[model samples]
Target: MKVLVTGGSGFIATWIRHQLLARGHTVLVMDHQDRRGGLLDGEEFFLGDVRDATAVTEAAAHADGIIHLAAVLGTQETISNPRPSAETNIIGSLNVFEAATQYRIPTVYAGVGNHFMRLQGTGCYTITKSAAEDLARMYNAYRDGGQVAIVRPVNAYGPGQSVAAPYGTSKVRKVMPAFTCRALTGTPIEVYGDGTQVSDCVYVEDVARVFVAALEHTACHGAPAQPIEVGPATSCTVLDIARLVADTAAEMTGRAPVDITHLPMRPGEVPNAVVRADTSTLDVLGADHGADSFVPLADGIRNTVRYYAEHWLPGYQLQAA
Candidate 1:
């Protein structure tokens, strides 16, 4: 099957494309940005934005399946400037859904974590994502031509995640990168609002596998995916993550143990928020999404730190030096 990955250059999308290629599936990449990630060969690339309906329709026409992942990410960034984010996340999703229906393509949606479990999320990104999820469900319920599956990934962190800029407009400030980068540079790791925010930090590889699995289920069974929910059984706080990154960096790079500084919580953040996905939901697809199957926080951190040391840290350090 030829799978069109909307956000082909993103961190998780890179892994997904590799997995698809490994499984002998043809990959079609469609993104506004050039292919900054993923394999260089064997990909039918389409340089386009998801916001354009015509672009999405043309791409979907050639795809047997679609994994919609293109969007403006980062909660705080979206909250600060919402018009563009809303346009991409909401309008972009609508275009994908419309295209799927038109072409009868089995589409997989990248949904958010358990952020909507407690309070109906209020942030611009959150609302837009939720609205998009609703569209997926609605389109599936109607079943005009195509079917859509949803994979709600929780706190995905790993290599290739961009480190946030202190001054410039960095798209996001991911914890894994921020902590690993600072620890490698022997700088104090900053935590937001006491670093007590609980998250189900799953490794990026595991999350990508989940996405691929759901897509396979939808494509093979020709049914809406079993609503896969992926997260860890144990929840790690923000401070816990910082400590893990710092400890791993110290062990791997022999960096002096860095301190964790608590900063005020950024806007659009909930300090008491917690996400523990019901991994059992994946049973419908016969995929092992059990709590123990996913990578542990400590092991994941070590891998992330090692990747940063080899792939990301040198350039950053050279710039700083």
Candidate 2:
């Protein structure tokens, strides 16, 4: 199968591309710019944005399927400047849906799974992603539209994640990178609120497998398909993840464990919510259900810690110097 991966340069998309190639499918990556590293060496790529209807249509042409991961994501980023992010998250998704319907190809959409959270978080990101997920479900119901398998992931983190990157957005506050970076440097790890909010963090590779499985399922099923939620069995609270990162970093890098500090929650954000994951949906969809089979939080953190220690820490030290 020849797959055209939108937002192919992203953290999850990078892993999805690798997974596709491992399965013997030809990958054609289309992103706004080239932020990828040697992980995708020698792969076919094109510079395109999903916001452009013509570009999306042309890219989907002659492709077996599309896993649409393109979006302006980040809770704070979307909350501060919601327009551009809304345009990309909502309008950009419309473009993908139109292209897939016109070409009659299967598609898989990446949803934020905000609705499953308590109060749905009420941020611009939650609003836009929820709207897009609704649109995807509606598109699947359209007689003329093709199947769009929706997979909502919770805190998808792994090696490809960066603290700052292609958009120059500071992802340091995100759970994985924030704790890992601070602990690696023996700095105080800050936890927002009372550290009671929980998240079902899923490994990126497992999330990629769910997307691939959805693509295959949607390809064979009829219209109006179901949206699968992928998450780990072990859901961790803010404090749990913080302490875990501190321990992992101290053990791996031979550094002292960092102290944890609690701060008031940021504006435009909610607290004391649990992000649930229905990995059983993976069993329903017949995908590789990750919670039981793939890397859990402890090992996932080790991998993430190791990745940042090698790649990000060196650059960070150079910058500090």
Candidate 3:
């Protein structure tokens, strides 16, 4: 199968592209061409905007299916400038759907997640993604040959991901990088708002695998198509993650994570964003099942810290101690 992955240059999208190619499918990635780094091996990269119907149509013409992942994401970015968020998230989705129709593409899979659920304080981003998910549902019900599969992922973290990217956002940047950079130089880690707000962190590779599964599932091409959620469903509070990271770094580097217990929470942050996935729905769609497995928070953090220590610590814009 020839697949077009929108947002091909993104952290998760890059993994998705890699997975598709591993499965022996031809993959094409379409994005703004502004994101650094080139396409994954065995993938064709296109320079275009998702909001442009012509560009999307041309790029998706020869593809058998599409996994739409492009959008102006991240709450901090959206809350500050909602116009581009709407234009890219809402209107951009419309363009992908229209392009699929124009080219008679049979199976179009749409990616929708965290932002589609509760926004809490990030109304700007939540609003756009929620509307975009709704638009995908509309197309599934009304458009010709529309095989729209909506997959909502929780917080997906993994290697080769940049802190400056869209999903990482300024808010997440302040937290992850702040903690790791501090850990590197042996400084106290700041704890925001008692660090109790919970989050579900899924590995990006697993998220990408599910996407490929959705694309190949024949049951997803039917009427009243299924909308499935994927998650490890492991809820870890901010404090939990922080403690785990600190402990893991202590073990890995022979130095304890600094503990600074008083820090303010970011505005518009959710108290708890837990993901609930229906495994039965996935079975119904004939998706190959994988373990609802998750890496321990400490392990993930250790890996993340090791990455930043190698790449960012030497000369990045990370905050100085």
lDDT (CA) for every model shown?
A: 0.81, 0.80, 0.68
Q: State the local distance difference test value for candidate 3.
A: 0.68
Off by over 4 Å in 3: 34-37, 106-112, 115-121, 164-178, 218-224, 272-281, 285-291, 294-296, 317-321
lDDT of 1 by residue, 132-248 (tens): 888888888885875888888887888777668751135687777878888888889988898777877898888877777778888778655456787887877878888888888
Clashes of each: 0, 0, 2
Instruction: Give a tens-digit lDDT track for model 2, residues 142-193.
Output: 6486678788888888886867542125643567887788888788888989
Clashes of 2: 0
Candidate 1 versus the native: TM-score?
Answer: 0.93
Those runs of model 2 whose alpha carbons end farther than 4 Å from true positions after fitting are 35-42, 117-121, 165-172, 222-224
lDDT rank order:
1, 2, 3
The digit string of per-residue lDDT tens for model 3 on 1-321 reads 888888888778888888898989898888898543576667777789988888888888868888888877666667777798799888888888787766666444444445544445455667877787778778777877665667776666766666643323343363565666565666776776766666656667778887787777743444226666656646666677667666666666677666756676665565554444554555544535443454555566777878876776665544433
The C-alpha TM-scores of every prediction are 0.93, 0.92, 0.85
Clashing pairs for model 1 are none
RMSD per prediction, one decimal?
2.1, 2.5, 3.5
Worst 10 residues of 2 by lDDT: 164-173
Q: What is the lDDT of residue 27 in candidate 1?
A: 90
